[model samples]
Target: MEEAMDGGVRFSSLRFISDHVGFQGTIKTSPSDFIVVEIDEWGQLVNKALDEAVYETSKIEPEPCHSVKKPKLNIQNVSIEHESHGEASPAATRYADRDQDHEAGSENEGSVNGVTSECEKGSAGLLRSLLDEKTHTLLDRFASDVKGMWSSKTELTEPSLALSLGKVLDKKQRAALHSAVRQEFPFLITAGSNAEVVVKPSPEYKELCHLVSEEEALGFFKYLDARKENSKFTFKPDTNKDHRKAVHHFLNKKFGNLVETKSFPGRDHSAGNPNTAAITVRFREKARGKRSRLECERRKAVCTAFTLQKENLEMFEAISFLAVKLGVIPSDFSYAGLKDKKAITYQSMVVRKVTPGRLKNIEKEIMKKRMNVFNIRPVGDSLRLGQLKGNHFEIVIRNLKNQINDSASLRERILEAIENVKNKGFVNYYGPQRFGKGKKIQTDQIGLALLRNEMVKAIKLFLTPEDMDDPVNKAKKYFLQTEDAKGTLSLMPEFRVRERALLESLHRFGMTEEGCVQAWFSFPHSMRIFYTHAYSSRVWNEAASYRLEAYGTKVVKGDLICSDEDAGEHFPSSKVHLVTEEEESANTYTVHQVVLPVLGYNVQYPENKVGQWYHGVLSRDGLQASRFRVPALKLNVPGCYRHILKRPHNVSHRLVRPDPEVEVEGSHADDAMPSLSLSFDLDASCYATVCLREMMKGDI
Candidate 1:
């Protein structure tokens, strides 16, 4: 109804996605892709001329706070440069990061030619060796980092091998860069499927900044000088390759005794191979244990057994709230994870557990505040950081793109593609968002390192424990490496050797079965989580095999019969009246479904060559979808939440038995580590760390 300076008009229930006007019918895409595209389009529009197009933008206070400006990219003209080549190696990596090649000399320009960093014999020995080592490294890192990774390179320059794989970054590294950089960037996804969006950092920016440290701005400046100062370039590419993995590395002895990682997302799925998403939880407020000396001494007796239960609602909110309730300023209580505002989540807390029942009114107060508690457990030691494992998530997406659009429409095309992917499977290409418009995908480099280590570990120690000494397997593993490094010591030890080490650890950390150091130290914080995006992938493979098996075979809907009581067990059979059980079982098969909610998949009119767009694409062919990947994380029952179980095959578990047969020292002969926990409800893109952070928050 209203017109703008550029003369773009607006209407009810209508929006523009990248110069294209959409109003439910004109454009559409999958929920996740649509969300990303929309955000990108909106961001592009907003950044064009902030003064002319910014929404309700106010003038900034022209304060001269460090005149250094960060990198800036033109959103409209932004396009990721795709790298095209083969497997890369550590020597091939030129850019330096936390673990980057600090020893490497200045990189030569225009090195994309097929020359190897270490070509051997006829080939460039340096290039070949580098490629081999880096390739394995990149792959293993991809597998470890549960959050996934990304890589960014200046458009005009060559990207390192790590950038090509994506997901080689650490949390602190990313945070440090985010804190420093102020300019817009382009994200390139070389590997790994993930959800992300492009937007002008606004409300979230101005507000979140309040939480940033006073030196955060300055710190970023320092970091920028350390990385991009020398390069007069901008942007980079993903080897144009697809599929990258995240790597998890043990980082114990780093946080000390302050905190530890939790094993599972929550009480629901803390057993084994947890299907919880990895969520990162940064401490926003300080702990109660670190308060003033006077307060600590005065309340030492009363505060020792301070336990937080579901009944004690205020106990978990914040130190301020707890201090107010204790007839004194809320201070002194410590916590680990942050719990949800709404839900009756079980939590473990540490407090004085002392005299006169200091937390006497906990039940009454919690009830008054409309909170419920299943139970609260008190332990001898405080839960350190990183003690929690991860969170299981289950979520639903509403208003899915309808498939009714007929007449060879885009909607139909998308449906078909989705069906194929669900059933057969699509190339696990890094989604467009992985290489975001402008964020330095430095993490991908780290992923490469982790993956490399894992592969070596798998090879040296044997893919399975039994194969440790298989010289053939070890050689095979070694062959996979790009470097001449002999063998990996990480997994070099034999079964007995490693068993003895763990037993020793258990002994040092253990005083009693229950009051053991293992339990106290091996909390979620102490453990780094590993998330598996294995379901859709495995399902796709399964569908592929299924389709190949049933390609020409035909069966009707009801071909499979329930039972054939008339037929004897040895000769069980069904009548021909309906599709026979054998016939149905033979021909009728499960269709592969899409991983995300469906929206037609159709290319824009000209984008498709041969004018052969298959199904309708969301928004493009006239359908709207979520701007983010709002996957329906349907969790299986008995899982902490329903969303964690996205696909039927997705299973979460933790090391339960720890292979009891191989008994040794440190590992509690009694309490065993789980392989992985079960899956549970969680929103799409929500990190498991976030959930564990919530659960650990109640711990004093």
Candidate 2:
């Protein structure tokens, strides 16, 4: 098989779809140079502003009845009433008496309407005495509003209110006012500043006010518990002891014996520390039996689907950042698929138990991370991988003047290349990202070793370095030579997560075979499986090249063809059928319709010469089909089939001069160098880089 080396990794020499003189250009000059927007299953482009109107309209449900009116409390009217009458209300009289007691330096405490006079002792008592008749009337009206809203169960459109105190108060006075408010109205929470006192309903108060009901809470818990295998869902950790206590108290008061509450130290706590603990609420043993009638009417779990637009961040990295901000685990989020790290991309993400309001709240924080999310709306189900139809790409290739003869020639060549790609398509080879940029030992080499049950060899290959002079590599070398994991770790950078993990494991377990294996296993399961995936990709690449060489643009007998009924479906390998002699004679199938199986134990290879090539390739790597099913290693890969060719749609290109204001490296300010802008749409899992490789006819 023809082989070529790129970036120190050997790959199959892929054939080009277009036969034309190639031009040279540089891509990804900036994050904005490449833009990717995912095309969903319905062929709708996923955009940052897509369905914005729908999201806006769907945020709040309409009121049940238009006749239901909110009781209005006018503080200005109360001020007028106080001005007309000289006598104060009974509540105001009690507050004045407490203020006098505090000024008299009384040691004995008094209570007024469940509020301790001790809370009115210091600056708060002085502030109350300083309040004029109109201010006292305003406080009375605010209390009236709170009671009316709480009793009537009116929908809380503005859950919080900020009451502006006429004069500025010091920090201590503000703190005292906050404490007095809490003592005066336990259901309402308050935060005070110099100018105003902000009051809002607490979680318990909200529940009591019918924002959520006891039966609704129980129903939600039942729904969540039914879906969980272990019936365990932990709440977000809180460092505040009062927050933890409040959660336990609220659950106990509401659910009573129906649910149990437990408090455990947070995951990131220090030993024997109670301050860093969290509370978890679950169904009690008595409540875990047969479902009650109310439980039987459990509501389905709803998820929020949003369009996430990120710049220069890996898909997982962006998701993790968002998960932290949303106060949910990363596993709770789902996406159609991963996108390029360095390019600006828009993709849809779905997360359960996260409301659109919560996502909207974190928009500012997320924007600081070079990411933004919008068009958030409720969805019935979470998005699954490979659910997307494809992705639309807008790419700009710069520095074209160095390669092309003239502007006219460049335009002609680009037009011809675009037409060729639209008509014939390119070889569907896995991109270099699949194997990683391992110079000394590619990921597939480690996979081959793992398949042969060489754990230590695989570990060594993973840790070994190609550049000895690099700081991280030097640390690796030191660890290899002296087995000083701790010393090497000191020299290593914190950002090198994989390296640091292995070193830490070695330091703890010692550098024995078991320790090495433990260090290897310490990696995430996805990472461990990635090595084998790289191996499969390598084999598929070679097989694809061999298929093209043996039978160029021809569909032969025994070739696997996906049935027309399943052609539009993703992962259509299950509907694959081998072409018979009669079908081959009919000459209905083309090479574009052919499919190749990635190496796996359960997969069916093509019944042609290309299938025979798989045996030779695996054998050369000291592997066989049976080796793929390794139970002990959990490496049983039920490999899937991929199309042999990919035809991009809506292919268009234009040549434009570089912007005079924008500075492109190697491009002079005075020089009007032409840049190629390409727009195309490729099916899901097809690499745009591969398409570019075809047009460039060189290593991308």
Q: What C-alpha lDDT do the candidate models reach, one value each? A: 0.25, 0.64
For model 2, residues 600-650, the per-residue Cα lDDT tens digits are 765678888987888777776778777875444555565667888888888
Name the 10 consecutive residues with the lowest summed lDDT in model 2: 73-82
Q: What lDDT is reached at residue 158 by model 2?
A: 31
Q: Summarize candidate 1's per-residue lDDT along 140-238 as a digit string, tens digits.
A: 453233113211211221111122322212323332222222221111112111111111112211221233322332222222222321221111111
Worst 10 residues of 1 by lDDT: 635-644
| Candidate whose TM-score is highest | 2
User: Residue 183 in model 2: shift from native, Å?
Assistant: 61
Return model 2's CA RMSD, one decimal: 22.9
